[model samples]
Target: MDKKHLQTPSQTIGPFFAYGLTPTQYDYEFKSWVDNNMVADIDAPETIEISGTVFDGEGQAIDDAMVELWQDDGEHKLYGRFGTGTEENNRFIFKTIKPKSVNGQAPFINVILFMRGQLLHTYTRIYFADESSLNASDKVLNSVDAKRRNTLIAEKVGQKYSIDIHMQGQKETVFFDL
Candidate 1:
């Protein structure tokens, strides 16, 4: 059998993306949201609870690791124009609304993987199932086999969505090198 190499969270020894270390663009809004009681009521019945485990290639849990996500709000752009952008952190809960594709384009959500020591900043893109038809039509996603394409999607569990990331190991999925 072929050896499957994997990296544990603790094994990450390089520079990890530092979050909350500095105030980001959304920080102001988030702060104001919290201060003015504008933050979304996550506990509301309408709110979705998106939570999951961050594992390494070895399937080890990475505690305290932050997952940042950005997607459209079922609004105008296939990708929403409301996100904080690259300069600002886009750390958000998974409970956001399911976005719609535009012009036959499946909306892609941007993700950033962050931890304590590993400086490796990986950017991952995810698409919605509603846009699976678009996935079948996307130049990039269609280039790959269906099995591999399915891996890029996050499973929706009731109101919660979950996507587990394996940083390094055999069969590791390549994340965007942001």
Candidate 2:
């Protein structure tokens, strides 16, 4: 017979996750047996680079955080995962192709952040700054107050796009429960 049981409390990623989560932590090339590739180049004209820093609630950089990327337009079944290095300034980068609108929604890269002091990973989306029309009509984006929508848009810099994640404080990025 089935018996009732208390669910276990969620836990943080912990300090030892590097060895198992990301290979770059040990100076080795990142290699995922399942995904095998980080760049999702379906039929885009050019590849784009996106990178950013992760900050903690205290405004300090989180050197060990990891980021997982999943675009809605997976017509090719590709994904990306990365580990932020312990550099003087903590940051993570991804090389990917531009995505197409999914289900009439604005094209965006879904991001999940796992870092210390976080019991559960946070979810966010990175929308392109140039997609004014799409961004204006996006349901997920419009759900947020217009004033705070900037948090989800990535700034274009040369060949790369930058979008920082502020875990707390007034500049906190818009995170979704899902």
**Candidate No. with top lDDT:** 2
Q: Estimate candidate 1's alpha-carbon lDDT, on a 0 to 1 scale.
A: 0.50
What tens-digit string does per-residue lDDT give for candidate 1 at 28-143?
42222121111244333343343445566667666545556665545522222122122212223444555556667666667666565556656777765555667778775665
Q: List residue ranges in candidate 1 displaced over 4 A.
A: 1-49, 73-93, 143-147
Question: 93-157, model 2: which lDDT tens digit per residue?
Answer: 77787688877888898898887788988899999998889999999999998888999999997
- What TM-score would each prediction reach against the true structure? 0.58, 0.85
Model 1, position 162: C-alpha lDDT score:
60
Q: lDDT of all predictions, in order shown? A: 0.50, 0.80
Shift of residue 75 alpha carbon in model 2, Å: 2.0
> Residue 84, candidate 1: how far off, in angstroms?
20
Clashing pairs in 2: none
